[model samples]
Target: MTQGSARTDLRIGQLNVAEGPAFEEFYEIFCEALPASERKPRELIVALATRSDYYLLIGEIGGRVMSFAILYLSDRYPIALLEYLGTSAAARGKGLGAEMFRAAIDRIGSDSLVIEVDSDRQDSGDLEMRRRRKQFYARLGARQIPGVEYRMPKIGADSPPELDLMVRPGGGRTHVTKDEMAAWIEDIFRGAYHRAVPREELARMIQAMPSHVDLIP
Candidate 1:
């Protein structure tokens, strides 16, 4: 499950357990790269790694952990969600992020992979960084799932932030049907978010989806 050329020395694989030095290293990188509002508690992350459907992909080089991806594979849906992906600050610009992304997709082995990115419409001060993030994923072949007003589930005391849903469609697929999108969202909310999101909020988001969701370039 690891991927790398001899020249790069990169290695990517799933970290099945939430204990020990490896898990601690991964957690360090995770906490360093993500804001508290965007991260799950360490205990919850540990608990999730024990699930059959969760794949915690950790990337390393020369035995040092550098990147990670949190993937949720849902048995009830054909799509998988890439909930979080990050590279250590020192690992940036070395292509580890893209490598981790590919590893997550390979692990999912699904025709569709969903991702949530901060919406440009939000007044978050990091607009420039958000734009670059969207561009990064776009460069990696993801297309925005237009017409759905996506938002993250509330965490702690922070309000949910607006997000844009993107899909990396496989098998030459170009779009998703309304029903398919709704089902995927439901699966993501229940399985990935663990239903931390209220049922009414989920329904409202699903209702906002268009009949045909085009992958906008």
Candidate 2:
């Protein structure tokens, strides 16, 4: 079913992931905007879309596809993970991305929505780009969790990518401590990303994280 919102011109709905020409084109465009590692093969995304825990939302403006968002609902908690969000090249600089984000939050009905942002890295030269990305989310009301340190698993021998955790907590969101947050974050890595975090590695990551509960203002 197509969902409508009066606040914007874009119409949001689920992407048809069935094997077909239209889906192929849509996925191709979406994948082009993302990194090679982040872009999954067609078969995997097709299977994921059929699962109850995953959602694929597309936003179209005047019949033109403009943005897409993938969300995952955790099996252990009533939390939604904003797995990936991207906008068509032509649609950048407009407010479509932010609108799509707010729509995802509204549709999921989850008070706490978690998003992973790449942390500044010395080897990677896109420090300003990374900062801008996080700022965009912050402007949309998402707050970075203080003291959280996340490292993305190595992709094909490249260094283990580091990331930061941010969340937009709605009215019914529960207040969790550092430990609880770490567990939830780990659950996302294991459940959504399918990466097993060893006990020792988990301990190390948690140790690197701050124990404070402050939110980015």
RMSD, every candidate, angstroms: 2.3, 2.4
Cα lDDT computed for each candidate against the true fold: 0.80, 0.75
TM-score of 1: 0.90
Q: Give the TM-score of candidate 2.
A: 0.87
Clashing pairs in 1: none
Show the colliding residue pairs in model 2: none
Model 2 residue 151 CA deviation (Å) reads 2.0
Which candidate comes out best when scored by TM-score? Answer: 1
Candidate 2, which segments miss by more than 4 Å at Cα? 6-8, 19-22, 121-123, 154-160
- Residue-level lDDT of model 1, residues 1-217, one tens digit each, is 4666333688888885634777888999999987777888888899888898888988878787888999888888677888899999998997888888878777777458899888897677999999999998999889877667777776656675788888998756777887787778877878877775566766676676678876645
Output candidate 1 Cα RMSD: 2.3
Q: List the candidates' TM-scores in order.
A: 0.90, 0.87
The number of residue pairs in model 2 that clash at the backbone is 0
- The residue-by-residue lDDT of candidate 2 on 114-170, one tens digit each, is 898887644578889898999999998788876566766654434546788788876
Candidate 1's C-alpha runs over 4 A off are 1-7, 196-200, 206-209
- In model 1, the Cα lDDT at residue 209 comes to 68
